[model samples]
Target: MSDKAKLVLGDKTVELPVFTGSEGEKAIDITKLRAETGFVTLDSGYMNTGACTSAVTFLDGELGILKYRGHSIEELAEKSSFLETSYLVFYGKLPTASELKVFEEKIASYNDVPEGIKTMIKAFPKDAHPMAVLSSNMVSLSAYYHDLCAQDLTPAQKDEVIVQLMGQLKVVAAYAYRHSQGLEFIKSDGSLDYCSDFIYMMTGNKNVSKEVAKALDVLLILHVDHEQNCSTSSVRMVGSSKANIFATISAGVDALWGPLHGGANQAVLEMLEEIKNSGKDYKTFLAEVKDKNSSSRLMGFGHRVYKNFDPRAKIIKVACDSVLKTLGVKDPLLDIAKGLEEVALRDEYFVSRKLYPNVDFYSGIIYRALGIPTNMFTVMFAMGRLPGWLAQWKEMVEQSGFKICRPRQIFTGDTKNTYIEIKSRS
Candidate 1:
């Protein structure tokens, strides 16, 4: 095989170098294509583009494989805590006992968010979206803590930023929810673990069940990193401009609030609620979903990337069950969600297309069981995704050759035409 891919357009031939990743993933490096040939490839939705090469998370959608630092999701979810997985994702290695201790201590040290941040969350209306409040408070951190944002951060300074976000993001998430509920803010418990502490802060109770903490820890580990998804890309894109850490994350929080990204779980819950209120059985609704003429569709049945199954879904599905059993909570929406999963898995229409239950399918159910309201689901996702965003931003900043991400587009409109004056236009 040649070292370059030759693209012959008419009589002009272009040579684009090929690059291979550690896992044999191949891409034709087109960094110089437009510069040399005065032409650029068009990839709509970036469906066929590789924005950046990353070592943080590896995802194989076809095979339903997800790994972090070369460890399988199953292994990490079962054996590692969220903080441990976070350390691995950022530093490229699991932490030693002493390292883990120091990391935990660092988190504990920075756990308390500023009074102004608490005040900011309270300022939002009671019915305001938690994501909106969360993003506002997140960006405010940059203004409150200017020392953490350096145009060129040293390794220690970068780590400090990462640790600070890891420490405070959960508090912000929980506080935002409380403010939405018109409840008072709760501080973190020094004795609780990371996930447990967040749960305590959200509910204002340090006494938490063991099973609940385990379930949350596993979910966080599963969400630690995904290869350049929407929010991660948002972080990298905004950070390319040398924005502060909080500002970049604020951008990500907004991106994740979109209905297509981190809002899937919220949609799932809403769909379940809609189905429950429809006065029809799930089987009847499932038929409507299968009918092409009908407008009904399943919310969490399939994924955009995973044609087979979502690896995270397979892991978190069990946690969902465990959480339901542990809390002994009951809801009609959960029953509908469970029934939909069972019937869809067996139905030919679903099985043929591989539209199995995805990660978000049961996540909202689990969140509901834990007493977390539907509106707060995406904020929880932002909390879990914090570490991944930090790692990706840190990697992009540390790369010496990285350029600002400026994607090109083909112009389809008329050019070289004089603009008509507003008064003369018919």
Candidate 2:
């Protein structure tokens, strides 16, 4: 027996013997800590947890590599459409010619929400947040598809539900917006592409140029899946409790509502509005972000992972320029965003943190150009990530050895206290 820590990561087991320091104190080589445990913290003060070794996506932060279903993200952004990438992420492969066709047909078929659901949506106050309505509507979907909730459902039945959820999420999301605005529900056009149809459903118009649709598609692809992110983890945790898919995904939606997560895009717009209202130019806004006392943060900047930079942001930057240029839309905020990125990149704090503009940065500008309200941005995100969460939930159940997720908490309350009866006290 060695007096060292043992860790297990993935399938690897490693044991390290205790180290004796010169002062007779035990010590660990902070810089030499290797990943051995499935999920253990290293002496270097970084967490190492084996969430899952997913074959669905690979992210190499140092190398700036991101792949979905084994295809390079750059390739997908340029060549493959968003729906195709979505199919890749959910189904674990690029859809073939016939498969893509059938997949599009299946998605197109689910373009309209039921009238009852729309009616229910209309009952909510117009002032209610769109995300709240979306979350409620998503949970309500399970009640409508009560038959699909059977525990002993066949594989075919499960796949059908998955397809249904992916397709219907758009309708549910768009209807939430329309219902809030007192506008009539716009049905999806079977002829237009998936993202184009979704944009049409929300805008009540089919005038989305091909360029805008393509940009929106790339944006959707970028957000499709990020391995074990907060919202994704929320879905898995809820699913681990044996909750039905709809409920699990609804929980995920609630998690994504946080300002730091899917809500970041909304925050970005808010920050931009603040800067605009302040009468500050790009330089002044950049300085404010750098000042510690100012306590102002450049929204849409920085990320948790990808210490080098966010690959998705890079892709979106290109697409953002192209879409805005092609549409002849002039947004000064775009220039301000670019200036902020430039100043942050040259600064020390941002460089050390590997903070870069993430998917949230360009997303708001694109949504603005498309006539989608800022409040609806996260709803759109929820719609795009639905397939990813569903696929993860399915994979977690089918392939991965599932476990009930229950985390521990350190107790801090008083151990004991005396209580007196009310009558006795009186």
Candidate 3:
């Protein structure tokens, strides 16, 4: 195999070194392309770009494989708790029993937020989107924990912040849900496990079913990390500027608020609701999705990275069914979701295109079964994704020869326009 790729610009030729990842993925290093050739590659949306090399998560979209710290996501989801998975994603190894206990204790210790954060949550209008409340409160944590925002943090200080964020984000997510519903906030006493405690706080139900908590834990494990996604990229971009961890995570939260990212699950729920309310069967709606002229889309039916199938979706789908059965919640939207998935799986139009159900499809169903409102869906995503964002930030700052993210742009607009006075302008 060639160690370098040859590029020809007019009569000049240059060799760019080739880099290969552990998973056999290859990229031609273009670090010096613009400097040597006075040109840059144009990759809109960064679809083919490798922003940074990472060891936190490995995603083989073509094969529908996802792993954290070299451990398969399936194993983690089945055998490990969310907290355990979080430790693996952040620390790059599965924790021993004693190490896990210490990690859990540290997370539980920081579960409660300061009173000012509660006040901040109350100040938002009841109708404000939970993502807005989440992002705002996430950034405000820096004001409460000065060490988290310090420009120069010791390794111990950084570790503490990681633990603090893993714990507090769950509390904030529950608070955002309660605030949106005009309910009183429930404080975590740290008696239950991470997912159980979150369920207790969100619903004020001390004895949430173990199955429900475990299902939520699985969902969180599934979402812990995905290569360089939009939100993770946002975290890296902000962290590259030497921004505080709180602010960097806040940027990620804001990015996840977009419908194209973390809000995907919420959109899936809305699509199900629309089908139910319209009195249309899943087949009828899917027909519209097949029509090129119709604007209707089969939300959660496909993924950007996983063209074959979403590995997380396979796990979450089972959890979704189990939760529905355990809760005995007769939700019509869930029925509609199930119907859509059943038909889409065998439908040639969908099969040929590989438009299988992704993680977002059934996650909303599980959340709904757990009594989580639609608006709070993204908040749950932010909570699950907290560890991933922190891990990405930590990796960026700790990397050797770290450079701030500054992408080059090809300007197409007029560059030499003469300035015109306001009165003379047409």
Candidate 4:
């Protein structure tokens, strides 16, 4: 190890003595960090830590670049299918022809979730959110497969666990959506491709055009994995505790259901509906977003990590235009979204912060076009992200020296407050 500490900022570098404290103590230890996993940054903002270099997605926040298993996201979205991308993320390579065929068959075969699971889903409250139903159902699956927890599961069985769970998430997602509305659940058609099948399952009528299905396919593919993202990180953190994949993934689904993370798409649509109900023009709404006094932010217009742009947003924008044109469906909210994107991209505050639209920006539009309810948006996200969580869980179990995640904090509360006598009231 180098004795000197090197600090590189932008193009400048400075060397200082390595930090070490007095006898039997330590000042700082840079050796513990996994620098190769991503470009190291010394920011006072937040410290994101994880394993050393690993095979998975790569995200460059400043450049707005995302790659999955060495393939550019744009390329994958345009040229690859969702199932193929998912296989790559999990297995670390694009599947061969036979492998791809077998994988597809495996997933399609498991499309039907157990009737007991469906029955349990119906017992949920009618007004329950789809994400909640989906998460609860996923945890319930643990009971059905409790035997796997104790047995020495084989590698092939592990693969089966991931593939089946990926397929079953779509079933659970669709069932939750239709169940909440008291609509009859739609069954999956084996002939239809993955995205088309998901759409068909929600909407009994299979009227989706080939072009629209293709766009939806790409959307699902692009969203399949984002390395070390909040929810994925949560999944790995929970999996580190030796939880089964189903339980760990359920935890991830619950985490993603939060408003600040995967639920942003649903929140964006709700915000748009609110803006429309306000009886204000798009320009007026844009003005409100700009007004610091209002403290109103344009939902889906910015991201926490992607400082320059959100790559998924770019792909979905193209799909949005295509789907709208192909379906000839026009909603006033689409126009508002376009206008907001234009205004936010050019504004100084957004420019300075490098804030741009994210995946949530166009996702709601696509869901609306597909006849999916706005409330089910995060369910769709959960469906797509399930594979990523499983892959991370498997990788963590197979490789990393995993342990239960219990972070420590320095306590600054009253150290020696005396307990008052209950009988001696003042």
Candidate 5:
């Protein structure tokens, strides 16, 4: 096999070195391609680009595989808590018993945000989106910890910021949810585990059931990381400019706010609601989804990355069922969702296209069963995804020979045009 790829130009030939990942994924090293050949590859939507190498998470979409720090998602979801999974994702190893205790304590200690931040949350309109409020509060953390946000930091300071962000983000999310309901903020309770504490704060329930909390923990673990996703990429891109961690993560929150990303779960719930309220049966509604000319669309039946079934979806489906049963909450939307899922799974139109159920499919069902409003779903996603964003940002900054992320583009517009004076325009 050749060690390099030969690229031929009009009268020039260049040999680009080939690099392979540990998993045998191969890429042509293009670092010197433009320098040598004066030509650049155009990958729209970055569909074929590998921006940077990472060890945080490995995903094989075709194989339906996802792992963090080399631990399978199935194993982690079954045996690990959200905080432990977070430690593994951020620090690249499962903490020792004592190390885990210290990590949890540090995060619990940083859970409380400044009182002024609560005041800020209260000032947003009652109908304001929680994501907007959450992002605002995240960036504002820089105001409280200026030293930690500096470009150069001691190793201890970096560790503190990581723990601090992980702890405070849930509080901010809870406060944002409370503010949306025009309710008073609930202070964090260090006595409870991370997911239980978050549920308590969000719902003002001190005695949250163990089953519910564990379900939430599994969901968070599933979302902790995926390889170079939109929001994770946003974090790395913003952090590359030497921006503070708070601002960089805020960029991720904003990116995740899009309907096509973290908001997909919320959209899934909304689609179910629409179907239920339309008085149409699941089979009838799905017919519209299959129609090429119909405006109706399926929100969570497929994924962009996973050519096979989504591994997270399988785990969360069980959790979703368990939580709904544990709470004894009967939501009509769940019936509709199940009906759609059953048809989509066996229907030739869907099966042939591999449009299977994804993580977003059942997550909103679980969130709704827990009494979380639809608007708050993405905020929950952001909370779950924070560790991944932090790890990516931390990895990018600490890497040797790191460069600012500046993507090249092929412009498609008028090359040169004279500006017309407004008064003289005919």
Candidate 6:
């Protein structure tokens, strides 16, 4: 509404320029706040802060809008494959027919991971968490491709690294899944496309149905990119120091491994199990969630970013029904999930609070139908989020005004303290 926002102090005034994005999202430029007025804004968790302006994805949480490079998510999910969407996220444009053919062929050519990496993966315990294994191998990739991540690298060299990582990470995830199950690792099939190959490797089912492959492709597309999520920010923070992609992505994997970040789907399943085991009806459990008297809480029903419905949830809900019906899955847990969602939508308490089912709500249920274990939930999330992290990191490297992400903090501890010898203190 205004070109600049004015803040008044006792005797001085500060004017910060108000910047609006292409989607009409506004953020005040606070870069000069500390310098001009010796005051820095304190925004814990950066909920209201604009850390950086990104051109990769646009999200309006209140309106439930999410778009990647100007394409509506629904369009991509219905029409494009994961590889095509990933290329769009990475390069900020959809690949042309010829470009798509070349990119897919190149990815196929670099499918298998290094043998040494596989040997190392085998050494981990069979019960080892897949995310840990995935991160370890991703970091180890730096050693195998040192030249690509070396200093003074060219744009073409970095692109090679990106391509290699994108293709091989699928292999790495498949290996991690097989490793966790103590199953022999399977090589990627050159005949399969990206999502199909991943499904094949994970399940060792040569004839994965067309429905399953399309389901996974849409899932990946829905999660292709979100604007500056925690793991993506973690990636940009580490990459700001000019870290190698492997190391930076490893940081992201660790961040996503946290329960609060990428484990919501697992938490959702655990919550469902808790409710089912408690012998309480869905309505009773939901009442406890609203009452707060019981220690019960609803997981995956709401998101921190979105105050309205999660746009992805709308699409995924339809896909969830289709996948289950097509596969003839009849899990009682899914029935419970559906029951919970139905009750939440009809109840006034949930509707007033905007606590509708988020994307993780349905994604978890579908993954269960697809036979993905609770432990591998976050690993699957990492696979979907890979392109977003890479796109953010690459933008930081090529764009201007990005530096090592060091935040200013208010000093609340003792300003000065004398070092006391142990005897003297006693």
Q: The CA-based lDDT of model 3 is what?
A: 0.89
lDDT computed for candidate 5: 0.89
lDDT (Cα, tens digit) per residue for candidate 3, span 2-81: 98999999999999999999888899999999999999999999989999999899898889999999999999998999
Write candidate 2's Cα lDDT for 1-426 as tens digits.
357766565676566666653224354432234343324232221234435545677776666777787678888888988677778877887879999898888878887767778888889998899889888877888888878776545788777877788788888887888877889888888898888888888877788788878777877888888877888889988888878777888899999998888998999988887877787776677777778898667778876667677888888888878788888999887887787678778877778777878889888888887778899989878877877787787778776556777543445699997799888885
Query: Candidate 4 deviates by what RMSD?
Result: 6.3
TM-score for candidate 2, residues paired by index: 0.86
- For model 2, the run of ten residues with the poorest summed lDDT: 37-46
Write down the RMSD of candidate 6 (Cα, Å): 1.9
Q: Which lDDT values do the candidates have, in the order given?
A: 0.86, 0.78, 0.89, 0.80, 0.89, 0.84
Best by lDDT: 5
- Better model by lDDT: candidate 3 vs candidate 5: 5
Give the Å shift of residue 58 in candidate 2.
1.4
The sequence of per-residue lDDT tens digits that candidate 4 reaches over residues 115-161 is 89989999999998888888888888888887656434679878988
Give candidate 3's error at residue 319 in angstroms.
1.3
Q: Candidate 3, which segments miss by more than 4 Å at Cα?
A: 290-296, 345-353
Give candidate 2 misplaced runs (Cα > 4 Å): 1-47, 281-296, 420-426
**Candidate 1: lDDT of 160?**
89
Cα TM-score of candidate 4: 0.87
The digit string of per-residue lDDT tens for model 5 on 9-84 reads 9888899999898788888999998898889999998887999999899898889999999999999999998889
Residue-by-residue lDDT tens digits, candidate 1, 1-426: 677999998899988999988888889999888899888989898888999989999888889999998999999998999999999989999999999999998987777788888878787888999899889888999988777777878888888888888888888888887777778888787788997888888888787788888887887787788879999999999999998989999999999887677888899898888887877777888899899998657877776678888989887777877787778776677778878888888899998887877778888888888878899888888888998999999899888897888888999998889889999999
lDDT of 6 at 236: 87
